[model samples]
Target: MFNTIEHINKENRNWLKSFYFIHKLSFRTLWARKASWVGTFIFSCCLLILFPFGLGTEALQRADIQIGTFWIMNEFVAVLTISRIFSAEQECNGMDLILTSKLQKTSIIAGKISFTAFQIFTLQIPILLLWIIFYNINSNILVNLLNNLFFVSIFFNLGSASLGTLITCLTARSLAKEILLPMLFFPLQSGILLASVSLTIHIGNNSLLGAFSESAWWTILIAYPIIFSTLGILLSDLLLQE
Candidate 1:
């Protein structure tokens, strides 16, 4: 149970505490279901491998190919990763238990989002290693790659987590919630996928673009997550009203 939020408590403090508690609980719950998490992780790895093929070797080798093949791979994995977060909970009736807890609604939602983000981060490691090996990138380029990957992961996670939270909240009671959840995330995933691919290509060609740079494309990546995370938090209150 969370420390009670008195009426006079500052909103920022309350939300911050709630976010922390929620993330903690979510991680614990997710750890309890290790098999499913591992399975999803492996599946993401396989999908990442298959994605480079879609871009073709020629494109992969092209230095100027905006949003190179690896970006495509990460984007694909992002979709699958985000969709699984809430849908898996729905299947196990975990959302109901979470909602019934004394924790703030925002906390519950943030916790789930955090867990999904961590899972996605874990899934990206092998893909990153593969890219490092295949691209024969120098040490400086490798550092840049890591920076880009970090931000891209954050961007995709925010959007995907927002979409997942929205779906889970809206369809918590529906028999078809599991299926419906993934559908809600598809469009968001597609956008992130495109952005990721474009960013990947840009970074591969130009080593100077930091992940959080002021460039228009970087702005898009940064903005999408901020917008979605805010929307998700706002929508969560209404969605959990029942």
Candidate 2:
């Protein structure tokens, strides 16, 4: 019994080390490519700027319309980020090094998904602030709305990022991966997007408790990450074998 417990604890510690190693690798690689993140930040700002002109400023101020537009912009960002999963490694055969090491494949996929999700969430923060500035939200509701938006953004990004990581890995070796990535990604992600939008609209109008009370929306928001993250971890070894 004592040996079994020690073995399990050792395994847990190793898994965490592997997870952090992969995450750190991704961070350094992405940070080296400043153009990618800089371009994405510019793209996000441009979207926010042009959207009002297309929708007309008056319509853009309407809560539902603006919220929906913001989410759609995030969807685009998710596609761009997720499409690049495993890309850095592919360029340098870094993935081969990782596979050849004793690092856990499950930890590897989790780390990649987490990094992508965290990047998306961080990028969205400025966009969210810009959104508040652009729409000139009522000062009274500003804090409350921001709180709700933050909550939704966390799960929304996680769910999309989780599934996107899996699909991106699966198609990483394909000749037309760029084309295939978005095609496979958007359809899978649409349900989560809708749930996020709906929750945003609800919480914008009501309170956080009110949004959670709507069980269907809440279920999707909660379940999406759990379901897809599991699939990603389970299939990662098989997918990465290629």
Over 4 Å off, model 1: 1-7, 10-17, 48-59, 63-67, 91-93, 134-140, 206-214
Tens digit of lDDT per residue, candidate 1, span 128-181?
A: 786667655556456776787687777776666666666667766688876876
Indicate which candidate wins on TM-score. Answer: 2
**C-alpha lDDT score of every prediction, in listed order:** 0.64, 0.82
Query: What's the TM-score of every candidate structure?
Result: 0.74, 0.93
Residue-level lDDT tens digits of model 2 in 63-171: 7777778887898788777766778777878888998999988999899889999989878888888987887776766777678778778898899889988888878
**What is the lDDT, from 0 to 100, of the residue 210 in candidate 1?**
39
In model 1, where is the ten-residue run with the lowest total lDDT? Answer: 205-214
The residue pairs that clash in candidate 2, if any, are none
Each candidate structure's count of clashing pairs: 3, 0
